[model samples]
Target: MNERNSASNNGLTSLSLIGDAAEVGISPSVQQARLPFTVRVVADDEALARALAVRQKAYMRHVPDFASTMHIPEKYDREEGGLVLLAEAKLTGSPVGTMRIQTNRFRPLAIEQSIDLPSWLSGRMVGATRLAVEAGGPGRMVKAALFKAFYLYCVNQGIEWMVIAARTPLDRQYAALLFRDVFGVGEFIPLAHAANIPHRIMAFEVGTAERRWREAGHPLHEFMVATHHPDIDLSAAPSLAWPGTSVDLQIPADPADINSGAGNAVRRQPACTL
Candidate 1:
């Protein structure tokens, strides 16, 4: 972790997404390639497709049989859920890196196989999955931006807690973001680790998180409040009176912004109620 922070990163920057390269009047692409880059929500299907395509490229470059990565179709255009994000070059309008968000906040456990634990039986607040960022090319910054977008979405949705299977490299960073290892507090059920990364668990109130960002050393704190998600409370409750695999779990609440507004897009909200 220390090496990642101290290691000098070199790469060609493309900040075309924000058109702020010349204005920052500082930190040209040449000097800083790893990031501190702006985050943008992708709306156009064409653009979203392009972002996913770029992610495929990066994934293929590293992950074996990269072509197998399923291409995500635009859900927003269909009046659905899910979000896509992009990082563009300020000077060139070129796409640099991207990430995505596919939430199912208040959905019932039976509706989706991924979420089997019932609310009352569950421990955390929200469950987040499909957090894929383009590898390399300032990967950490790109990842942080993706997380920021998701954070704002959760806040807008009135979410009080968040859950995830965080990559090991991000253990400390996620901890800083207020995500605790699974079932560490209160009566909780732990998710078994799968893939190479452990399913890192986290929970935090939006207002509290905002305070932490304010009182901390993070520079991208503003990103935490930029996006807007409608109030999405789970009204969570345990599915069964006690733990049992045979019984189906249940949480009577609205599912999250799974396929909303065509991938991810810039959201201007009346300041995050942080």
Candidate 2:
């Protein structure tokens, strides 16, 4: 951890996915030849397809029924205020991980349909959905990198809270990351946007991530904060532009009727809200 912080703070160019390249006996030139992985917003149809493929494959392993619909991208993928993050192996250009992050800019979050968010959770909140990763070679490491990308995006966009509806067992991972239950502990709510699947609603305060981790001596504190991942790119582009305007979404109060658009392009409101 100290080494990562030193390298990052000193602006070293030999950073690796999980450790320094030099420590792994790889020459800088060889290390630079291939990117370990890349994290970026889905910008084109091809990229979206790759993301969908990974999402489907990963979800199928755990939730086959829900995974069926994931073959095609959803409406929220292109929402101006929401974007999909795809991680690909540079060597093959194949997606290894994917996550959909949607901010509550114009409408309430998807989980809101199942349970009302407290006022404290209102405003500048971002929700991560469809988080999936290939189950090989440093899968945990890949997940960490993807999370770092998510954290950076939230910071850049001034997102306050990072929220998710995690399923059983998977919710334990978020708990290890210090995410708190948004409603009740062990209470699983069926999410409308998730094929009526039950998930535990959880949230992490974005702005307090650093402080909380440091104070708690969190296991991921160093990897998340001290380490710098240049591979995770969030540069602005045509498709990557954030939708600054709010879009009117007809949110339903009942989880059964919550039909939050997934792959569809957001119908932009005249004035951007977020």
Best by lDDT: 2
Q: Taking the candidates one at a time, how many backbone clashes does each contain? A: 33, 11
TM-score of 2: 0.74
Worst 10 residues of 1 by lDDT: 19-28
160-245 per-residue lDDT for model 1 (tens digits)? 45555544444555665655554454223334422232344444554366556546633433333322222211122222212222
Residue 58, candidate 1: Cα error in Å is: 3.6
Per-model TM-score on C-alpha atoms? 0.51, 0.74
Model 1 CA lDDT for position 16: 24
Report the lDDT tens digits of candidate 2 across residue range 116-139: 887778667889988898885545
RMSD of 2: 10.9
- Cα-based lDDT at residue 145, candidate 2: 69
